[model samples]
Target: MDLTPYVETLRRELAVAAEAGGDDARELAERLTAPLESAARLTMLNVLSAAADEITRELAPGSVDVRLRGLDPDFVVTPPPADSGAATEPAGSVEPPRAPAESDEGGTARVNLRLPAHLKARTEEAAAREGLSVNAWLVRAVSAAVDAGGTQPRTAEKARTVGQSFTGWVR
Candidate 1:
């Protein structure tokens, strides 16, 4: 998870490459290494993030996330949900859920959500616990809230005929 080692290796390689060019090249490499260290780390993080997104898509419903802890990037993986019938049924007997046929009903749109760092971390943890990607979790949550007309619990209505049964004989 520590990116320090990788950055250090890159710096060393750069220095070694410069060594062949002469003293001036070596001095330039040394000066640039300090400034380039941050850029190198950022590029590494980007690559890791992209790789995680690709893996997440392949996994679908499950997820792989690259989280940053200080200067390190940590990977968090959530495995696909296990089918209840799989253990009881023979291999290849249970069919995987089919992807919804291409639909024009409504397409997905990206929304840029900015949350406090702590809240973001909590959301990620919750998604991981449910074995879902953060996007999927957020979508489901938003849908439910919209469908229910909000997050508050609905008030129960008073019964109109409580214990009031009338027994009548037809005339």
Candidate 2:
């Protein structure tokens, strides 16, 4: 959204308010307005982000995100799938969920790693696609790889077919 108009309106209001105090106050307001523009934009962005989060909560399984483009924030909304609660996975699909397990059995540790800008963006996109945060997705991935002792991590297809059965008549 274009914030120029809103920021301008704020500046105008500040100027009008300072007018009551005479020339000194008016000059100070003009000087301060230039610095305050950035602060105002940041505050506005924060408000937009909070609003998007609240809307997302009310639209669970769907989401709203505020993306910054230059100085403006844009809203991106992902509506719930038309088939909502039908199988979450496509038929014959074998991708495992990457959500982090909720377990109190282990202590948490923090590690710092840096990646190229492109890789970081890709990781964020992958996490968003799976409805998980980047940290959670990374933790799940690391757990899978470590559990395999550096061998190839098992895929969902291999992990589930053993001792699984369907006991129903097929038409």
Candidate 3:
């Protein structure tokens, strides 16, 4: 009575049936009800500590390399092959998702910058060409650069708000 193969086989069959019903609404709801659910959101380190304990045990120390890896508590897992006789890694093994570790700036990291007066004026003139004030222009410029795949960490919300205030002051 080798139940290992039979029990696992039955488990797989049941999982396939359960999955055919549709997407995991429980998981989706967890993600969708965010900000609202953000308060309940688990940190990745905590999640990794709990969510996939079995898989993490298999990883070597320092194998988990990531920056924004801790940003998402979720990990994606791939299923094992359906062939029963094959000796392979079990299904439901977890893998971490992460952002690239390096940037295109050739390892020169960004620092807080104070704009020089002439450079600021040049930026203001460019903004003027776009019918924007200097601060607004810089915000828009930074946003555009981000949209083009730059990974700046600075928040533009404050800059944009100040720019709008400047708009009023100029009047």
Candidate 4:
């Protein structure tokens, strides 16, 4: 069946509907509506029936009859494939799993305490001794701490001090 005219009719109707009640589209709706209705009125009922049949066959179960709406009702009956009835359940059932807690920014406090005045001043002195701004100093210190697996700059530096002390002794 030639579905082109019906498809064009639907398209025109949609275009008219899309433009309805808008000032810019007022003329367009008027121009398209008549042609759309004319095409719709000329559509073959058989084509619509065929499209509906194709949709039904795709959706219905393959192993059972699917009855559809009508006066006497239409049905599509499909017998089970030869070995379908003999299928057995697989051995194991999976246990439901627990969902892990969500992680979000700033959810856990990594920075334990604000530096005390003496410690803060020492930190500033340490940065100046290393020729860096406080931010840069902290960044370097953090990198060192992470590399040496410590929480604080002093702990990371302690590892180096201990290493040097061991190497410099008994020379």
lDDT of 2 by residue, 64-98 (tens): 77899999999877663345433654466444433
Best by TM-score: 1
In angstroms, the error of model 1 at 154 is: 16
Candidate 1, residues 1-171: lDDT per residue as tens digits? 989999999999999999999999999999999999999999999899888876765675666889899889999887766665456654534242322222466533458999999999988987676567787677556655555465454443311221222111122
User: lDDT (CA) for every model shown?
Assistant: 0.70, 0.69, 0.40, 0.44
Candidate 4: tens digits of C-alpha lDDT, residues 10-105: 776677676666865767766776676646644434344455444433432121222334312244434212333223423332211111222454
lDDT per residue for candidate 3 within 65-137, as digits (tens), equals 2223433433443222133422443353322112123335553123466989998787877655544434334
Q: Model 2, residue 137: displacement in angstroms?
A: 10
What TM-score does structure 1 among the candidates reach? 0.60
By the TM-score metric, which is better: model 1 or model 2? 1
Residue pairs with backbone overlap in model 4: none
Q: Estimate each model's TM-score.
A: 0.60, 0.55, 0.22, 0.24
Candidate 1: deviation at residue 145, Å? 13
State how far residue 136 of model 4 sits from its true place (Å): 0.8
Steric clashes per prediction: 0, 0, 0, 0
Q: Candidate 3: deviation at residue 39, Å?
A: 35
Candidate 1 versus truth, CA RMSD in Å, comes to 11.9
Best by lDDT: 1
